[model samples]
Every structure is written in C-alpha cells, then in structure tokens.
Target: MTDTTPADELRTAAQTLLDLADDTAEDMATNDYWRSAVVEPKHWFHNGIDNAVGGPAGKLAGLMSPRFARMLAIYFRDEAGRGQDFDTRAVTLARVMNGGQP
Candidate 1:
C-alpha cells in the first residue's frame, strides 16, 4: 500500500513540469509534448480565459533553458522571499518539491 497523501500527489504533479527541465538541454516540458502529441492536448490551466494567459506563459516557461530552470528551482528552494513582492508560497512549494535538494 502507498503511504503517499493527496498533498504528496499534488506536489508530484507540480514537480512534473519542474522535472521536465532536468537532464534537458533547451526544452523543459518535453514529455507534455511527446506524451500528448497526438492524443489529449497538454494544458496547465483550462477555461478559455485562464488558458489564454497561462497557456502561453506555460509554453514560454517550458521553453526556458535547462540552466535557467535549474537556477530558478534553486532560487525558489533556497532564497527566502522578500517583502510582499515574492510570496513564500512558491518558495515553500519549491522546497517541498525539491525536498531541500540543490
């Protein structure tokens, strides 16, 4: 039996996009493309409005170089958030997903 909780599954899902950047040279979400190349479409946010915005942003983020992705991941994992500018949610999320790994 699996000991994973719902939160664990969500973190795992979030890690999916982040992990696509790993071991990659240029692209991040390679699996999102290949896995759904001919079947279901790949999407981060559904709904016409949200998809309109997040769709492009997600695609752009996914195109980030592996180095950039790694650095961002590292930043989110280690650096604490300043003022109300960057919230700690992402930081905490990254820390959770990375499990304190750098």
Candidate 2:
C-alpha cells in the first residue's frame, strides 16, 4: 500500500515533466544537435529554456544567481537524462486525475 496521496503524486509527476524538458534542452545544447546551417544552438537552447521554465517557474529560475542557475540546469539535465515523452506523461497524468489508472 502506498502512503502517498494523489495530489503528491500529481505534483511529483508535473515536476518530472518540467525537469525532463529542461534536460532535453540541455542535451540538445551539449550534443550540438541544435547546430545546423539554419539554426543557432545558443538561440535554440535559450528559447528552450524560456519555454521550459516560462511563467512562474521562469520567474523563480531567473531569480537564482547565474552560476547557481547554470549548475542547477546541468544537474537537472544529468539527473533526468532523456527519451521520456512529455505528451504521453500528460495523457497519463490526465487519466490519473480522472481516477483512472495510467
């Protein structure tokens, strides 16, 4: 039996999705996947960062010192890794919220 509440699980899963997006952006930057004749990696990376952490999360992440933010980005990127699909997670989360098993 799990002691965790539904709200707790939902919050954890949302954070995981955000972290996954952040990590994917970092990977794109690190692996030079954003480099191409038509695209600049720096612009692509920052755009991703903005999209990933936008709104309230963006405000909080922006409040961190430059070094701390960079470190945290790297940490999240490494810890979360890649290949997870946020779209699928969204669907699952929706199901769970509706009292259905994902």
Candidate 3:
C-alpha cells in the first residue's frame, strides 16, 4: 500500500501545488493578482470565521505561497489554539453522538 502518512499526504499535496506554481511562473505567488485570488479565501478560524472578518480572502496559504504563509501567520496568531479547538469540537461531537454527555 501507499507509504504516505496522513500528515505526509497533506504535505505532498501542498508541495505539489507549490511546485506547479513554481513551474507556471517565476514568481506566481509573489504576484499581487495571484495572492489576492488564491491566498485570501481559505483562511478559516475555529468556527469557520475569517480572520479578516469579511469576504473570502482567497486560498493563498493553501496554494503554498510564502507571502500567503506570512499573511496566514498574522491572521492566525495561535496555531496550537486552532488545533485544540478542532480537537475539542471533534471529541465533543463524538461524545454527544455516543450518548456520553458530560
């Protein structure tokens, strides 16, 4: 079977897109147009909230742009918090569905 772990799968996907950008343009992500189009949409918070608190920013971070990475950094200040929030929600939902209310 595939030797990829879940984490590695994500990395591979990200890197694949990044490499595509690299091939398509010498500076694809660095371009303002690409940044505004791709990086701005997918920056979601714990509750599907936009960090900028408005319309879609784009999918730049997901596209593997460095600039998008930096912007993501600013928008999502606490990575651990986000992960914890997701985990908390998942466990809570599981417990609720299993009738293990607490």
What does each candidate score in C-alpha RMSD? Answer: 11.1, 11.9, 12.0
User: TM-scores across all candidates?
Assistant: 0.29, 0.37, 0.27
lDDT of 3 at 13: 35
What TM-score would you give candidate 2 relative to the actual structure? 0.37
Question: Candidate 2 — worst ten consecutive residues by lDDT sum?
Answer: 78-87
Ordered from best to worst lDDT, the candidate numbers read: 2, 1, 3
Q: By lDDT, is 1 or 2 better?
A: 2
RMSD of 2: 11.9
* Collision pairs in model 3: 38-59, 38-60, 39-58, 39-59, 39-60, 40-57, 40-58, 41-57, 41-58, 41-59
| Candidate 1 deviant stretches above 4 angstroms | 1-18, 26-63, 80-89, 92-102
Return the candidate ranking by TM-score, descending: 2, 1, 3
Residue runs of model 3 more than 4 Å from their true location after superposition: 27-102
Model 2 clash tally, residue pairs: 0
- CA lDDT scores, all candidates in order: 0.46, 0.50, 0.37
- Which candidate model has the greater TM-score, 1 or 3? 1
Best by TM-score: 2
lDDT, candidate 1, equals 0.46
- Cα deviation in Å at residue 79, candidate 1? 3.9
Global Cα lDDT for candidate 3: 0.37
